[model samples]
Target: MKIVKAQDFDLRREVEYGSPEQNEAVRKIVADIKKEGDAALLRYTEKFDGMKLEAASLRVTQEELHAAYEQVEPSFVEAISAAADNIRAFHMKQKRNSWMDLQPDGSLLGQVIRPLHRVGVYVPGGKAAYPSSVLMNVIPAQVAGVPEIVMVTPPATGGKAGIDPYILVAAAEAGVNEIYRVGGAQAIAALAYGTESIAPVDKICGPGNIYVALAKREVFGAVDIDSIAGPSEIAVLADDSADPVYVAADLLSQAEHDEMASAILVTPSEQFAKACQAEVQRQLAELPRRDIAGASIEQYGAVILVGTIEEGIEVINRLAPEHFELIVDNPMGYLASIRNAGAIFLGPYSSEPVGDYFAGPNHIIPTNGTARFSSPVEVDDFIKKSSLIYYSKEALLSNGDTIMELARREGLEGHARAIEVRLLKEGKAGANDDNK
Candidate 1:
């Protein structure tokens, strides 16, 4: 890694990421699926996922789920179950209550909070089996009191047969009501517009490939979508006291995620920066995905040598990273200063995977620079709130004259007369007063 003066490193431009062409492809698929329905979905699924299944078999049955449990290791299933407990417990804190307040006048006003009737969570299976993702996406919906949650993954083919058994086991633990072995744009379309088999969902959550994101965009008006997630990212702000090895390892953790993934390190210590550079090289030699990590680092990574720790923090704030790790001394002191970040990991012990797995915080974080405005997946995503208002007869009577005056001022005679008629019926107004 080459050390760069802070001025030479660009932060604003680096934040903008994702493929525009992919967005276009998603639009086309969504439009066709809307017009052609299941037939269009089948064509896309077969073309993209290389699986051709009848629409009837899209849903995974209990028998298939049992087989999945049998296939996965018992220890893996148990671990997922344990993680589910933590995820559910954490999200339960985010649960909202329906509230109403009765006025002194005979009127009640408040908000009603209700869970979405149904939701669909997409799990990416084209590259890897994200059992962790299954847990993260499903647990929050369940905690939010969503009645039905469905999961979809690209169908396993050849010797591969279905959604990963580990993913299935996690889904089972996370309270997912149904699992579908379908993937890509087609899956998004199927969830948006009900097919012969798949029920239309009120909302769709979870991360996916570019095609999946495009499909979600196309279906926006028809169904709510959590967000169009981009490639993963991590930014580490450290000082001389921060361990170079730890910094290098954390940077590599995100770099290995994808070629487009970004791993940035900002430090005030030139000596520490060089040490981290060396440490990254030493560790990269042993990493399983070194090629991917190396490419990501070469293309998207940066090591900025700032003149001061405050500058490092400023750079991080400007980046608004998806994952922000503070490996500096007094990490907590700077927590409030960080206004933008999908998740913050303080101290070396709090590794990225901690939040990704056992920690109750949702791992579905904002990607690219979206953390500047968006937030991580939480129970709030599955619930909606409506405001309420009411007025008593006495309250209406007291305000009726002013209300009619405003309505008549607006030239809405009908509106004014409506209130006048009510007042007359209650004998509150003179019948001959014909202002009615």
Candidate 2:
């Protein structure tokens, strides 16, 4: 790992911008899926996944779910159940109730929250069977009171590794109503367009490969999508007191995810920076995914030895990482200064994996500097809010002239006329600003 002094602009940009191939391939897959539907899906699945499924058996049934339950170890199922409980408990607090506030002029103004009727969730299968993702995606919708929840994952090959049975149980624990043995861009297309085997959904949430991300981007107009997620990222803003071993481990946790994933360390101590670099190499040698992690570190990872803690904060805000770890002595002081981040892990004990697996905060976060704008998946994603306005005859008469004046100023004749027409019915006001 290369240790650079605070002012390395080129390295920062490289870490922030992800691979262009991911974006280009996503576009092609989305276009193919849109034009060809199930046929396109089949071709790509065969091309990428090497799995063949006849048209009729795409959706997984309750019987299969029961069999999935039977397939997994009791301890694994229990762990998923516990994790689901934590996710549910955390998200339930995010539920919003419709409310109306009465104004002094007898008008009513407020907002109503309504859940989307149905939604589709995509879970990556094969070597990456994230049962934690099942909990994170499904539990929030359940909390938001969505009536129907559907899921999609690629089919397991002939008697080979299948979608984790632990994930199936987690789906059950999180109140997911349906599951499909389909994945990739095709699954996203099926959910968006509704083929013979799948039902169209109001929104789609969760994460997947580049093709799936492109599919979501392509189908955005057809159905609501959470976000076009990029590679995973973690930026730890630590001080001299922070543990290099723990920091290195947490950084590697995200780096091992993929070659595109970025793990950065922004610290004030040169000693801490060197210790972290050495620790990452020491830890990487023993990890199962050493090659992947090492490649990620070589390409996207960095350890910047900043002149001061304030400079570290400036760098973090510029990077706008998806996951941020504050390992300083006073985390709360810096928390207020943090302007952008999808989710923040405070203190030494609050590591990234806690949020990824057991902690209640949804692990589905913004990536590749999108944290400056996008947010983590929450109950609000599955629900919509509508502002409600009501004006009684008295309230309208009082505010009518002002409303008409604004409309006339904007040259909206019809808007002015609509107010005049309402006022005329009551015979108490005119189209002038001074009703006083």
Candidate 3:
């Protein structure tokens, strides 16, 4: 890992917008799916996923869901169920009811909160199966009362014949039944524009490869997408009191995610920074994904030297990392200073994986410095809010002139006239009265 002064370090990573070829390819796939529907869907599925199937086999069967349990261990099921409960409980607190506020003027103004009618969660199904991701994406939608939660994965995982049993088990545990055996950009297209078999969804969520991300971007206006997530990131702000071993391990936790993942340590003490860098080297050699982690550490990982803990925090806020760990003498004291981070892990014991797997917060976090403005996937992502406006005759009559003035200022005569027509008809009955 490179050790650089705070002033010397450039924290921004070059955003991946996909190559021109990839973008053109995605556009073609999306357009074909839109034009051809099921025939196009199946043809692309076979061409990409190498699975030849009819439209009848598009949806996963109930027997497949039940049989998935048999493939997974009883212990695995127990653990996932517990994790699901934790996730569901945490999100349940985020649930909000549709409310109306009644004013003295007999006006009803508020928000009508309602869950999306249907949502599609795209689960990546290649070398690794993200059962935890299935839980993270599906549970929140369930908590938000999304009636139909559809899941789409590649027909095969790790070049195998069927979807990962663990992913299927996780989906079942999270209360999702509608699933399909498809993947890549085509799957995103299918979700956005309905096929003969798969119905269109209100939104799409979950992680995928470059193709999937680009597809989500292409189909965005047609259906809402959670986010076009970037590579994983973790920034650790530590003091001399922090353990080098713990700090190195936590940093590597994110680095091992991929070659593009970023892991950085911001500290004031040069001695501690050197210690953590050496520890990261030692841990990286022992990791199963050492090559991937090593690349990430070589390119993106760093130990940033700062003048003080406050300066380190300033660097952190500038980075706006996806995951942040504060390992200091008093982590709580610094919590208020942290203005940007998708998920925060305070102290030594609170590792990032705790939130990623079981601690209840969604791991589908905004990435690539997006935490500065966006947030991690929450219950709100699966729900929509419609503003409630019930202006009484008196309320409209009292406010119509102000509304018209604002509208006219914006040169919207039609908008002003719409309110003018109402006031002209109703203003005859004591328009000057303060109360109805």
> Largest TM-score belongs to which candidate?
3
lDDT of 3: 0.92
Location of the lowest summed lDDT over 10 successive residues in candidate 3: 427-436
Kindly list the per-residue Cα lDDT of model 2 for residues 281-302, writing each as its tens digit.
9999999999888999998888
Q: How high is the CA lDDT of each candidate model? A: 0.84, 0.84, 0.92
Clash pairs, candidate 2, are: 153-182
Q: Indicate the residue-level lDDT of 358 in model 3.
A: 94
Per-residue CA lDDT of model 3 for 31-140, tens digit only, reads 99999999999999899988899999999999999999989899999999999999999999999999989999999999999999999999997546899999999989
Of 2 and 3, the candidate ahead on lDDT is 3
Candidate 3 runs further than 4 Å off: 408-413, 423-436
Model 2 misplaced regions, further than 4 Å: 9-47, 157-161, 432-436
lDDT of 3 at 322: 96
Q: Which candidate comes out best when scored by lDDT?
A: 3
1 against 2, candidate with superior TM-score: 1
**C-alpha-based local distance difference test score of model 2:** 0.84
Q: What is the lDDT of residue 14 in candidate 1?
A: 47
